[model samples]
Target: MSTQKPIRKAVFPVAGLGTRFLPATKAIPKELLPIVDRPLIQYAVDEAREAGIEQMIFVTGRGKTAIVEHFDIAYELETTMEERGKDLAVLDPTRATPGDIITVRQQVPLGLGHAIWCARAIVGDEPFAIMLPDELMVGEPGCMKQMVDAYEAVGGNLISVLEVPHDEVSSYGVIDPGEADGALTEVRGLVEKPPADEAPSNKIISGRYILQPEVMRTLETQGKGAGGEIQLTDAMARMIGTQPFHAVTFAGNRYDCGSKTGFVEATLALALERADMGSEIREIAQRLLRD
Candidate 1:
């Protein structure tokens, strides 16, 4: 039985008007926020590339033109660095060539489902990966790659799931398991941001998804489930009986960069991992705590 289905395209929804970050987000896209030296979205794209994704489709919104430009080649900057014999460390990550990237504008202020729907004409019909830039997963093999391997073994719709606190289950899409292996669970049902007491299980959706093309059709008419938006969970829930849906409970640390605290924590955590800046970052945090 061949499980692999030539999953090449990936859809990244970056159109969210990050109101939570406020004034800072006014000028900058939340996806562009720095995680160490690399912007958050770059990590998402890098993860997709590592997982054998061929085309990068960024679903962007107004005021997100810069997002398109960031992935483009900066000729002047590259030329200057080449002439000066300076190591273009910055250009290393920015080296994703022109054709590999594509952008579609989500003119309306719709939810994640709508943002994905915008890429339908381009995506056509294919099993694609969806990675939210805000969810930064730090792991040995990268989160998406782990999911891709699992998808090969399991051969169905795969979602990256992790156990969060029971109290915090309401903050995420909860998954109910029918059968469980070491790191994979046969998904019984999906609860979108249920109340703490009503949540089916502690396993919550973390942002990495290896979804089937049929999901796009569901999203097209998903209407609105949670928060009055066409929830992706609502669509996924519908596919339970027809297709094999499983949650891959892989081990990794995920940070919610959408929130201020999460963003700051990610910055400090990554900074502490760097050889040049770790000492300075640790000392500053220690001094701040001491004072």
Candidate 2:
């Protein structure tokens, strides 16, 4: 039997009140924001689906029900489309079979750690993946798929890491890398939002993580860290030495849709890739540049 434990469930912590996007986010969850035509949450869920995750555990907060509804059957809409012969294929991405998706309320906005901890009841004792919908990762095989492949080979915790500019390291949780062999880097330590100069390495932790269940137990008592919230990195940091910890360098572009700049960039980048609108969007960009 393969020593690697199967990662059947993926947790999506979408409870954060997206303050950065202001009035736009005041009504809609940030995860519902579009990257091209698809909502940001769709990308994350689609990535998890591609990675063979059978169940989606959404740690949601109030007003975040839309994220769950997005994956549900749109009976009226689908019936109308079918009756009109409008081709229901476009609605395919929005539908999820019953029992495949589940949600638990994170009634409070504690932190990412707390948001993840809220899903503990469903996670049980198996290894699971966490995908931050705000961090939209784009790759041919999908970021989660890449991590799943690595997890099967190593059979321990695996996090996606991206080599960013040193100056940008302080804004992220960076790894104290022990050794690197190709795309996999051994994680010695993790410092969340350290000063740029004090950072151990520029390889910052991205959104995707395949973590052991023990980390949930560690988070049960994890003290607040950085910005006075229960930081997930703090919990994962404490679990570093107890088991295998490594970072997989993501072979893809990561767009931080959590911020305005990153969100706009992601929108334009993905929009420019569309078959029907690529030329039109490019021309608009060219016109704006000329004016």
Candidate 3:
């Protein structure tokens, strides 16, 4: 067994107002939005579970109850499905054991740093993961699993990064790199939303993160950065030299479900990958393109 602390918990910050989706999101939590058939949050949970995460910590706000209930046992629904001879196995990935899942209210719309800091008590002193449900990553081993395997080898904070176009660097947290080996890049520094001309590298931090408990301590005193909010990048940047901070360049397809375009693209991509819907979806795509 590795002597490094085992990562058993994952923190999910799902308290966003999701204004981008407008009236549809007015009554529904954006995280509950269905992509292909499964809700966005379900995919994130599935990735966490695949990576051996045993406990889920959701930092929620008001009007986010649907997210909680989605993971709970739906007695009536299950009974109906069973009576109708429907497969219960399909729901397995969506359900969680009673004590395995927990939620804390963010209460206020602070930045991502404050949202994560809200879960400090539940996360305690162990190394934990931070997964944004908005970023749906599809891979053979799943994104988190790949990071977990890398974490076991390096034993420090890990964040998923992807190389975006240089002009788009201003839209993301760009990394100042050092040494590199394979998929791992030494994150010497981080610049959040820097102008394209000033960005150190085109690699931007993606939504998946494997962070240490010490980062919570750094977030405690982290001031507002970038968009006048306590940005998680600021706190994480402070930990770069103090700990083994590295970025894992994900080798998979990452769909940003946080935006309208990305959401539609993810739906189509996933639908095309499904055995039940692939043929029909492909045909529809071909027909639409020819029109």
Among the numbered candidates, top lDDT falls to 3
For 1-291, candidate 2 gives per-residue lDDT tens digits of 568889999999988889999899898998998888799998998899999999999998889988988888888998888898899888787889888999999997788999999999899999999999999999989999999988898878999999999999988889999888888899999988889889999999999999999989999988887778888988888888889999999998999999899999999988888899989999999999999
Which of 1 and 3 is ahead in TM-score? 3
RMSD in Å for model 1: 1.4
Which model, 1 or 3, shows the larger lDDT? Answer: 3
RMSD, every candidate, angstroms: 1.4, 1.1, 1.0
- lDDT, candidate 3, 1-291, per-residue tens: 677798899999999999999988999999999998899999999999999999999999999999999999999999999999999998898788888889999988889999999999999999999999999999979999999999999999999999999999998888999899999999999987899999999999999999999999999988888668888988988898899998999999999999999999999999999999899999999999999
Give stretches of model 2 more than 4 Å off: none
Which residue pairs clash in candidate 3? none
**lDDT (CA) for every model shown?**
0.87, 0.91, 0.93
Ranking of all predicted structures according to TM-score, beginning with the best and ending with the worst: 3, 2, 1
Please give, for residues 1-291, the per-residue lDDT of candidate 1 as tens digits: 655786798999999999998888898998998888899999898888888888899998888888878887888988998999998776676677767889999888767888888888888877889999999998878999899888888777999999988999987888988899889999999887899998889999899999888888988877875567777777888999899999998687899998889988999998999999999999999999999
Model 1, backbone clash pairs (residues 3+ apart or across chains), number? 0
**lDDT at residue 7 of model 3 (Cα atoms):** 84
**Ten-residue segment with the worst summed lDDT in candidate 2?**
88-97
Clashes of each: 0, 0, 0
lDDT: the better of candidates 1 and 2: 2
